[model samples]
Target chain A: MNTHAPVFESVAKEDVAWLGTDPIPATAYYDPAYFELEREAVFRRGWIQMGHVCELPEPGSFIRRELEVLKASILILRSQDEEIRAFHNVCTHRGTQLVEEAAGKQSRFTCPYHSWTFGDDGSLLSAPDFEQFNVAKEDCGLSKVHVEVVAGLIFVHLGTPESGMRESMGPLADRMDELPIARATTISEYVYEIDANWKLTYDNFQENYHLRFIHPSTAGQGCGGDNPFGYPEEYGFQGPHRTQTIWTNPETGIPSAVQGVSYMKIGEALAKRDLMIPGAEKNYFALFPSFFLFGNPGTHFSHVVYPISANKSRGVIRLYWVGDDENASERYAREYGMAMTRDIHVEDRSVIERGQRGLESGALKHIHLQTNEALLRHFFNEVDGRVQAYKAELEAQGAL
Target chain B: MSVLPEGYEALEPFVATYAVDNAGRRAEMRGEAPSEVRDAFYAAAQPLLAPALDYLDTKQFADYDSGDKQLMWMMLSLAHVAIAVEIQQEDEERHAHLRSFMPVTRAPADF
Candidate 1:
């Protein structure tokens, strides 16, 4: 193993205290070294959202997903016996990517590079020169990752088995269950390749303070009227996850004045229908590292931020709709939901890209954060803690 | 009343077909709703169809590749329109009682 020791350091006195109430140092968004540290300390150890169970509902159904920079491709499969399984997408033979397609159902996976085949259970089914190699077929099965399903949503952890999925998720699974997630169906999925750090995108999603300005049409109209909603200080942290639950009045259906313009309109509408869960209503849950899930009674939308580089990120938003009718009405509902999401996402993307450019100027080292954006502060604190912990582990192991 | 516009007939069947196909997929993900209701929905959307065959034929997905970014944007936009129309139509029907009371009177009683 090429152990070029990872350089880990405490944020300077200025950087450390700023995280409490100010935006993180901009350099953290563009520095290559920071990205590497994040991969090891954060992404590798974090519980990442994979896909919904609906995506692989059947016994043989499977979906291929990747965490870009980690070079980790996962094959989420439902075996013949109906057990959900997740395996590293790499073939055991020559270490080639087994499934090249994004998603499909299959009984077996064949590696194009070496023609090695693996069964749905990830057992090594066939390999050339099997007898010549002393390795047993059972022992040659594809590597497996820890997988967990919480409220029809699938999550994977790259960490050790001892870490445990339930332990990793902590209170998130319990909190998520309070919502009507089981009723949700996939409405639409949008992916964007943004020229900004993954953290920058997370920073944008962490607070609703920007809604009045950036999303004036929607947020301003919906909550900014006489009500003028605000984030509660009752925000709490569950393991690496941070959550803030907000309660909107039942009478006011989403404010039409800000209907099309606000980013929260779709979420607000869904919440009113009782399709989304109460915890997800008007509240935000920032699942540490890379995933954020927004819950409401009618719909649940999640955004997964995959870091491509220090300055580039791939953001995926999946909208889940809850309804029995899959007809014109439902289709129309889904389309409208998607459009609203697109408009808001476009606005966010524009701002983040500009933020990235601003960071490059080096004119400013840090940005300020409002009290309502307490989640962002928690995120930075978690990141800092993880980095420190990883360094400590390396030092104890004599690896640093 | 607006002559249903040009290509509306051809678009109708395409829209209906696409809606039916998508409804099937959605039904599979969610549980089955009333088949008749789903069928009727597709039937309604059939008249508003506009297939992307022509646009897709000319543009190479690989050439414009931004890792499914463009395709996602288009799909999201389409989904938004789909849902918004449903909400709007439902709202209109729920408030139809209010509109029903508007009486039609002669422009001038004296003739």
Candidate 2:
């Protein structure tokens, strides 16, 4: 058996020590109380990626996202000024959600409950019985969420973060900015509402260890054999964020039967061009908590894991194509790439639910981590560190 | 009572043919329907779409007028036909159906 050692040299200095020895406690996956702690410690305070700027290509366009775990209904929109912003979807008057549709475009939004209106910039424009209210209209504008757009991706912080997304991402920004993400357009989206914890759903994407076992037919065939996958070419951490690069096996050739697909040609063309991360065909960059971007040469795909409860989560995978100019070749390529990625996603879904069931059973006390699973260890360490610090702070205040 | 545009009495039976199953799954074509079938359906049903869309745009759908509802049903049925054609095209062009399955059958075993 060939076993490759998982390297932690790229992990943050504080997180490096927990690599091999830490057997992740089962409670981290299935415990309801711990899940609540995670919401407070992690999801609430950090910068969460909402969507990409390209999604709102035209000024005045908007998209609404319902984040059930954070108890947040958010509207991320581009104003008439062409700046993207995020705001609570709730009306300030009676707290009725201002936007009803998942997405639409308008320079102004009027709450359906009352006639309260707000501009795309979130400034209150008007409300019913304005003189009857003592509060200043200026003060009652839709509440703003801290929003920043970096490398074409829009991120919102629900609570105050110590630093902005650009600063927090550090060197990772240069790597992500180099991609044509700003010019890339979204082609499609895949949404999965699963019966598993958000972290469990995310952990499945963080490693390539299960490719041979779990994806034996779909991804395994694409990789070229039973053991076609390999260790991440390069991996590292920037604050709470991290990334890993996986090189495509150059020897693998597409079966002629599948060659008509434009997606099949994308990999071969990308391998010849040095557009992606150095020495890798695909790179997985993760913003700690639940956002991940998997970038290949001609395309990039993202996954947002949103916790619905301790045991339920919603995963959205959005695919983007960098070159918008579409001819016959480009159209075929996009379809092929989307179909291939989708099948692999279906394979992973089965195990993620089953793994959660195993953790809930309480028969297993600790889940073992293999040598190549170093990133999983690094992830747990960061999560544990944050949750513990939050616990400590609450204890100090006598609030826990 | 059902409201009918004067002289458009044939609309009810056509709309009744399009009701979705209780499971909300699209009603399937009984046998393999060709693209020409979809093209013909879309061509014939194209005129009905405008009034239904107009009702949707003007928010008259909320009123649930029987005639408008019948038009909506016809529009939805045409969409199902187009979707089934697209699904077939995806299967033939990419062999997507073949790659996504494991060979198993519920059909009666040959004697």
Candidate 3:
């Protein structure tokens, strides 16, 4: 580690050296065997970010999400009691897939294949022939999945979670609760399927070293003068989770004409709600094992990477807005904000796919990481730590 | 009935082309328009951005007459085109292909 205590507006190399400066094994990113281990170790016990609570506003509102990593389809809903819950999207009888529509309002789900129906609360409600099957009605209810809502975001645990996300997140959850997402009644969203590992896609957003080269247009004025690479001014760790204090651009004058007006309108809307102030609110959160919220009230966006296979993953990006547009100016501002963010994202796609192809070739056994990509290193370590421990458990049981 | 508001008669030609009902459809139009069309529209619409918004700001959404509504929609479409003209430029063509994968599924503007 270079022992430089950063001068003025720079991050110190030694500050994150304890995470190690060694070349990480390239196989973890491409090997199918390693991906399988991660499904159980990392994805199973973690409180995965599914969607926001705003999606299910009231009783009977529901959404169906397919989690490919676990080979499960989840149905999340707000029941009559006004409690949010998740359950198997499969019917109890013959396991037919229920809820063909992605989202809607309904208090009951009727299986098209067998006519078995379930209540909003996941209890068995009806059947066509009354008693041909030898199972109790209570036993035929949909399987309940572990779900919890905190800070207006919903999370689900496939396995027994040691702790809730809010408790585990500590102060990060509280800070997020204060962001616009917590109060959001609506959203702007887009989704993409990528030819890369989940970690590879997730890592693309965690570090800033690639910002200057890959996102020149978006990063040009944003990267402060002293910091050309646009690296975060500070790095933080909270258990397996991480945070980065994004470098604030001290204004090199307003952007191009229409773009400038868009930014001004967005700032005014945010200021009206008293959320445009400067503080640690600029910090971006990387909630493991696969969610990042680049939250600042003005341009807050969250991205979630869901693993599809060893060589593929899907990303869902969203901008959570506090309320519906009150006028044309606000509408214009939100649309511009989304289009600009999407422009930056599309530019990074080809580069990320190229990186995945190089790793999949089986040529490199190890990949190097500099001090700037510390968050990437920290993520790999945390993921592998669980994989190795899970391997050890299997070995002790003579299953390996 | 006029396609556009009285003062904005200069933009009448673009009214039929860009006056779409929803935000996502407007976003698609940004990518599908011909290069010459993009050039002409960008040249015509760039200077009027602030004034159009200023006009729309005077009326609450519920009270918008047909001309006011059409102008508002056109201005929203311009949000996408301005980036293509100013920032992305020639790169916008290739970028549009990658953008198709991430469709704008939901937006507050859609409502």
Evaluate all candidate structures by whole-model CA lDDT and list the values in order. Answer: 0.60, 0.66, 0.86
All candidates: TM-score: 0.71, 0.74, 0.96
Per-candidate fnat, comma-separated: 0.08, 0.00, 0.79
Query: Worst ten-residue run, lDDT, model 1 chain B?
Result: B102-111
Model 2: CA > 4 A from native: A1-20, A221-229, A260-280, A323-325, B1-111
Which sections of candidate 3 miss by over 4 Å?
A1-8
Pairs that collide in candidate 2 are: A262-A333, A263-A333
Off by over 4 Å in 1: A1-24, A168-171, A223-234, A247-280, A395-400, B1-111
Candidate 3 backbone overlaps, count: 0
Tens-place lDDT digits, model 1, residues B26-103 = 322111333344334334432332233223324443443332222223332334233324333343232223222211
Give the winner by TM-score: 1 or 3: 3
Predicted model with the maximum TM-score: 3
lDDT of 1 by residue, A144-163 (tens): 98898876778887876446
Model 2, residue B35: distance off in Å is 18
Q: Which scores higher on DockQ, 1 or 3? A: 3
- Sort the predicted structures by TM-score, highest score first: 3, 2, 1
